[model samples]
Target chain A: MRYIATILLFALKYIALKLAFVPLAVILWLCWITAANYRKLSLAKSDVELDKIDQMLAGIKDKLPMDAKIGFRTNIDPGRRGVLYFKSTLILAPRILENNDRDTILLIEDPHLQPVLDKNYECLERGGNQELNYCLMRRRN
Target chain B: MLFFAMLACVLVLFAGTSLSLTKTCGLSGPLRFPVAFALVLVILSYGYYLGLLFQIQIGILLLSLGLPPILYLAFEKYKSRQLNLSFPKKIGSKNLAVLLAILVLTIRFNKYVYRWGDWDAWAIWNLHAKFLFYPEHWRNIFTASLAETHPDYPLMLPSLIALFWRGLGFVTPLVPVAIAHLVLLAIPVTVYLALKRAMHSFAALLSLLIFCVDTTFIHIGGSQYADTLVAFFVLMTFVLYQETKVSSNRRLVFVLGIVAGSTSWIKNEGMLFFLVFSFSFLCFHFKKPAVIFRYILGALIPFIIVIHFKLKLAPANDLIHGGREKDLLSLISDPNRYWLIIKHFTMTGITDYWIMLLLVMIVLINKMPVIRTLPFMAISLVLVGYILVYLTTPHDLDWHLGASVDRLFHHIYPAAVYLFLLKFSENREIRLWS
Candidate 1:
């Protein structure tokens, strides 16, 4: 009886471990297919302009503290502009938004918006060539 | 290095708390790890609550003070087994099965990382983490302008992220990713341990793989939402409740209460599950009143934390705030809402893993035992509660169903599978298959 019990236990353990691999195999295949499709779509949507926006934001991020609030202004087309500013915010994140506030860091991406921003804030820094002009500002008051 | 240091501190607190709790209940070995981990999470969440209410320094102090006695007790327990902390009872084929599950889940989690989680992750959970990371300005998140972000959602996930980032002295997107992967891995680990305790090793491991690989579990678990975490606590509550039935250990009952109550800190749905668990325990075990008291006492530990958060910290939940009578009236009058929920519930289960689910359910029914039906009963009640939420949801019925029905079902799937496997393990006739 003891022998039978021990054998039964060993066999069950072996079977359980082996059977588990079947699901593991299935999951691997599923993940592979999912990753393939995801990578393809992500690669297709990759943007150089968005990368530049993020780069500019990264530079600003190093200068600001964790608690700093950032305001955004951009003339890139409404949809693409939102994407650019969103990518910029992702650099230092959590404190950046499109709102007016005291001691705010204004991120201006177009010269036209600069006139409006210049009324309320002083330019802190300006960068980028003619094709992608931008400025950083602080609230004047 | 900083991340590891902070994680080590949290794990020490978790291990000490869980091991001490297990010893208190006269339980030994690895099973206690998952339960202890869950309890520690609730405690850490409470610590976060303290930080929000008072000074962050005080919260950090409280968190730091919590682990020493618990660790001592755990050390005491381990010394008895010739310093063998390996938990030999937990070893065997189950570990092999668990290992394979981990490998598969690791791959799945990698995919999740590449995609950067789903919408609720970025917009809600991770966004909240950013807020919590700024202790001084965290309250800004609840301002009227941020209402769309659901500021009233429970803070367990964000609090945990903030706790780790504070240790590292900075925030990064990687924080949420690491947290998500840990939680994703935790589900299978917890399930395996809990099932091993409830049933045989083979049955436990088989159920663990099935539970882990379910398409819905894999898909939404990566989304970094509170749902998967909520599911873990819900399942743990059941697993702990099963332990209480086999042993007359009142500590186990108390632990069950803690697990069930901790759910509320995860999501509002967890609060509903806690109530259902309470009501089910009362209805089923009214003759055994101490069981009820023990469970309620355990639950109250976490419940106090939740009360502090809801009353002192969080905004009133938007779903519960206004036009309730009108919504209820409209929901009752419309038969279509009921059908829509039922249809989606059935359809999502079928498409996710219907063949396996149906087979398990049928076998469980055929071999159903009279003992300990309350856990299943509690889950059924919670499902009913979910449906009612849909019926009276302020959002559009179609949109709400489309968005959440599958994820909501995923919440209960693992526990349900665990129950069926427990039944399968218990049935002697089914032993022929092995």
Candidate 2:
């Protein structure tokens, strides 16, 4: 009976020691769990968003000088406007973006929406898919 | 051509940093590469400042800077009449599985990486990089109209990205992406090797495992933010701090000072760390004036440059812009701010820094003697400094804490884990190998 009691005491100490590393074990396990999030990731839709910005820029590539500053105004909703604006800034990067200026490039979110061009503006081109509407302007003196 | 250009950049960087490591610090073979990788970018970033100061083209500046290191190596090779460092032309199969896993993750993560990076990356860091990439209107990048992009922030990340852009003669998304990937992988490997050197192999392995599963580390690392690099340097400092405690090689502590100062070049949080670390270091090492002098000597150049940038070039910080005494009194006197800070600290502590906290709790339960170390004191003081900032933050309490507290923790979590695990060695004693 005494011998069995000694074995029980040792088992308790061993179990406690093992329990000390339970957090570390859980940490290692967490990686496998978290890594599963990447499996659902895809490139199809996001790629189109960036490429649309590029496509819009491609139409005005020759007209805009390397160092010119062009204002950008987007009709996209406030919620998604930041996304559209930043993407456009990168696409036309090295060219500073000025909002609400006469020398401007306009991006209309919906294809149906035509940018309202005033007397000072003449359309350079509109080139983008149904997702984006891009327009370059030549100012009319 | 792209591959060759990138290879040339990496080779040039390796040539410079490897020679630097040979003189400044003694690290083992496997350990050398990660530190060298980090030091190269930092050197390039520092060089950017000098380039701007001299009004020289960045590409010319970098090549001239790199030339000296090559010349130094040539002299060394001539002096020794042989080469001691062997360049490995192939990745060994021993670490192939690990390499393959990292490669898979890199490719997978890039698929999700927005071509412009996440909001802060593009709106702030990479956007600033674009200005440097096209310097024709560089003055406009720092104008009040561009205030939302934080022109006051330090230039390490943007400058490093721009350096590559300047070198390659064109900007590509691949430069920043590759950098982010390498930094993510480097952080774990660096601390792992440092720990293993300190005779804590078990703790080192756990760090690798912990980061592998850390969603925040992976995400922020791939996001092109500087927080992970901040984390990387903090851990490196912690490892080196302990090295000075165990070894008679006092020069290691000097290198630690250099690494610590380099952190300030990365971001404002790094500046906070530099201040707290300076105080903690002095308090702990005050017994030896000689050691203090060595540390200060190392930190002096970086510290002066950052001060010049802050005072002369950069705008006032958002948190501390125009306040004299009223802002501090009101922000601190209000008790609700305290409650909000505590609430967020607890919540974020659980969610974001859980792994590090778990290590802390385990060490406490097992009663490890981690409290006496320099890293423990420095990091604790830095945490207090973070809380103090929260008290006086200008932004709304909820918004301020919600947006930043996690990234704040990211800056120090790995080092915190390293500190606790210093005593979590097999014998449960914080013994460092001499």
Candidate 3:
């Protein structure tokens, strides 16, 4: 009986110790993965373009009389033409022009306001010219 | 130099208190010095806190300059307390040998503090102290409002550290770390005394040695963590509870309740210990229900004060929130996470080894003739209940449960050591070794 008890105790302890090793392994794996993929995504344009983007955001903020929240999403894709994408939201929509490219159209959603696009030549010409892309919108509701 | 100064002040205040308490009790002889010393230390701790309040430089200096003497007094008081209790004057050679072994193991592996992971100490515990030191940045510690990281850990340890920093003229992160070590060292001493009461001195010493050298225990003790403090209070409550049981001193039981409550104040998991003790006391002392109830109330008073301060008074951002919603099953079933926690806990060095020894001693004692089956059974039941608690904790099976298990082990260590000693000393041969 004593021998059996000793054996059982040892087995239980051994299993306990062996079972405790998993979390450490997982933690180490996480640390390694995070370290490998950690890099700051730098926007690939001159300060002027970056400043222009900030100015655009600021201008949109000023033009919208109502308080419209703005947020930005950035992703890295090696093959994409534009390295950076800026999205802006306004309170209301401006008038649309006929030459708008539906493919790159920044969709504006407002229950109260109709969709409008800048078809003047400068806005369209600037859209495909740079490695940076701007999508503008106004929330109507 | 600042650390030494603070130590000195604490010692002096401790000594003064010890002197006063001994004088009041009219207790004299070889025990006087030690008793006086312990009283002084306890007294001086409060005194130092008072100095911090008034911004008295002299008071601060005195408290800081007096800590060593206070510690010396406490050591003396422990010895004196043993002598008064009719304990053997000298420990037997076998027990001494074990003590030496533990001392050697501890000293040799003391460097593990620098080697072992102290991520929690660095990130949470010390970070709280940093914020407390510069209260202007208190907002940074309340929530991720100032930073993305969570700030919801219990504040007892950090608050104590803050108090020490404010009381002293300087700051060193090591102050709180040192206090943790001090509490760790005190656990064996307290356990030794409690065990001596129920068993032979030699058995008590052997148990102390085993606990001192336990790998996990030593690692936790040395770390800037609250586990050791929690363990100390848990042991204190158990010791006092046992004392009340044997002597029927309701006051001792009341005191035990306060200590039990303080355990909860130290950490959230302390509530588990508090509940276990309350249940144990209620069941054991059911015939005297009113006495038990009063003791429970005494314990709850201090606990409530601490809880009120933490939840209501402390900044809202620092309050741990997401705990209200948790999943229990994941903590037990997740093998990968659970094992990682067990490994770290077991590898805490010599302290873990001691816990293993304690487990063996408990088993051996169960076979002994002198131990009464009832109390032993009761303690075992409580311990099993604690383990079940670990199993049912609403934490992720892998990581959270594992981490909590480590903390829970610490909470019960003192009681475990005391019970092991009590059981081992049942043998006549072991008793004579003292």
TM-score top scorer: 2
User: Which candidate wins on DockQ?
Assistant: 1
Please report the TM-score between candidate 3 and the true structure: 0.55
State the weakest 10-residue window (summed lDDT) of model 3 chain A: A89-98
Comparing 2 with 3 on TM-score, the higher-scoring candidate is 2
My TM-score estimates for the predictions, one after another, are 0.78, 0.82, 0.55
Candidate 3 structure quality by residue, lDDT tens digits, B30-131 = 233323333333334334333433454544446454655566566666866732222233334423433444344345234444311155554455555545
Candidate 3 docks at the CAPRI level of: incorrect
The DockQ values of the predictions, listed in order, are 0.10, 0.09, 0.02
| Pairs that clash in candidate 2 | A31-B213
Model 1 earns a TM-score of 0.78
Ranking by DockQ: 1, 2, 3
lDDT of 1 by residue, A49-109 (tens): 5445555556666677765666666655676664454445444445545433445654556
What's model 1's lDDT at A114? 37
Instruction: Let me know the DockQ for model 1.
Output: 0.10
Residue B300 CA error for candidate 1 (Å)? 1.3
Error of 3 at A117 (Å): 31
lDDT tens per residue, model 3, A14-125: 6555434444344345444323322111222312333344443444444433322232222334222121221121011111111123222332222233323444312221
